[model samples]
Target: MFLAAMARPRYNSAGECTFDGKIGVWPYVEWVAAQKESKNRKRGTMELKPSTSVGKEKSREYLIKYVLPAIKEKWPEEDRWNTIFIQQDNAKTHVDVDDPYVLREARRGGWDIRMIFQPPNSPDTNGLDLGWFNSIQAMFQRKMPKDLPDIVKKVEESLEEYPHQRLNRIFLSHQACMREIIKHKGSIHYALPHLKKQSLEATGDLAIRLDIDLEYVEAARVFLATP
Candidate 1:
């Protein structure tokens, strides 16, 4: 999912916006035919492509062609001074971080872009997986797409309408989940901490950044050093 459908949220209480920045969604599927004709469309005619196995090569191309350019284009120009990290779940099809082509492309146009994998088996580490995807999935499910194209259209609609503030909160939750991981030595048994961000925001008390306590940082470091 990209930012094109909606604007990226501002961290402050004002809920101000930078721009109606959009990173358009890139569906990887090519049109394919329905085995049998359906009410939606004729058989063998153009339709949304189903997931046709994203191999490493395709992932690389996606990063190069779609993801990176979107970031460079949609990302706020003022915030381009630092590295941009695009996180992916630990999937086999994801390109290696150090892949030469990826590294080269990431450094293109003077941007310090990079890719990183979410912690294995830790869905909490992925903002989308933590909540956004589930929320969209629920909405998409309600659409009850009869065919793959319908599914794509419905899902795209779901994503486009998805609130940017909610997306930001999910990312905040993901950070809190990481803090929980540090406190628990990477254990998944920790409960999600409730921030009541909306209330905090109402009072202008919401923190834009979640600071990992010193002990929590030390704990994570020690745990990593032990192995």
Candidate 2:
């Protein structure tokens, strides 16, 4: 499987899109020399094999060695020092926010990167689940990759071909979902909210951030305060 990371598309002071928000995608695989000749390759040919173990150590290594560098490299130069939060689901294999190696690498180049877990059992709150994974998967399915390497290549191509506007819409939907969760007293039973994002963008009326109603905020506060 591949691990992907992204952020909301960002614009510069001139309103020009500086970042398309595709941080990077990496596969959990390593090269190994074939012990014997196979139908696909000669003996001693190096082949990509998926990692046998994917636990905290592996996750930490990926974050420290790959994800962090990608984020720093692709993030806007002006915001390099900003506190960037990497949201992930609660998985046993995921690295802790306070992982020492992660902390050490994240703070390099004066960047402040942190990790946070999405709400438990709330897949809609994840931007990947909201749309990204599906978008890339749909595109790659049409490619009909012949092998592991081809699959990785096709997946990366799909990510490159994905429309930035659609990704922005996904992030908006993610924010809207969070608002719904808050408005419903932390319940995840609400229907998905539709913003007609494409139409709005066509009319040049797309909002960068969705606003939460004050009444909903107060209601949520009251709910939390109740004995």
Candidate 3:
């Protein structure tokens, strides 16, 4: 199944002892989708970091033109008919009230997509969102950006500096967690806590369980039959 995750990039400025900052930086939204493996294996992530600041119009265009197409390309031919599991946070840009254009277009596109929202204030449930941002923050922590352009440049530089092996490891870690969830019969709480802890430990034990027994008989049957 295609498991997707989304997050927003916030811009904050430093302030002096008794002074207020004047510049207000705009927010940027990012989305990533990956194929989940049996033993919590994950493929490379296809991500979208939009230039347009967070808004309905910008979000709509980016999703329709970029994110949707990238996700569509990743689905297997047989699984193309299956609904894409889009794990979305409670972001205003994602479920905007002002414009329903993106929703309408998404429905029209041949993407069988559904939003899987996490509980409010629950970042731990979404691992990739935490993983990617943490890597970026670690890379850029030594310097402060003066403006949006500077921020973007630093982000790009960090992305380049990041090793492919690190990303592959992240994807694999997420895949392992998803497998645990499936094994535990869609129980996010059961899988996430352990996965989070194991990720910090960096042990390859995450891939140990190849088959998780599904609570639903039909699900187990389908999973077994899928080859």
Q: Against the unseen true structure, what C-alpha lDDT does each candidate score?
A: 0.60, 0.72, 0.43
Error in Å for residue 182 of model 2: 1.1
Q: Model 3, 1-227: lDDT tens per residue?
A: 01122211111233111211011112354555545544443565554444435544655555566555654553345445665554555665564422366556555656655544554564444544546567656666877776555666666555445543343344445555556666777666653533453564376343322233421211111000000
Return whichever of 1 and 3 wins on lDDT.
1
Worst 10 residues of 1 by lDDT: 218-227
**Candidate 2, residues 1-227: lDDT per residue as tens digits?**
76778777765555567777777788889999999997888999998998888888888888888888887777777666557778767667887767888888878877777777777888786776767678666766766688898878877787788776777777778777878998999999999999998899988888644355532221111000000
How are the candidates ranked when ordered by TM-score, highest leading? 2, 1, 3
Question: For candidate 1, lDDT tens digit of each residue in 162-224?
Answer: 766666565567667877898899798888899897898778776554455532221111000
Model 2 residue 90 lDDT score:
68
Q: How displaced is residue 147 in candidate 3, in Å?
A: 4.9
Candidate with maximal TM-score: 2
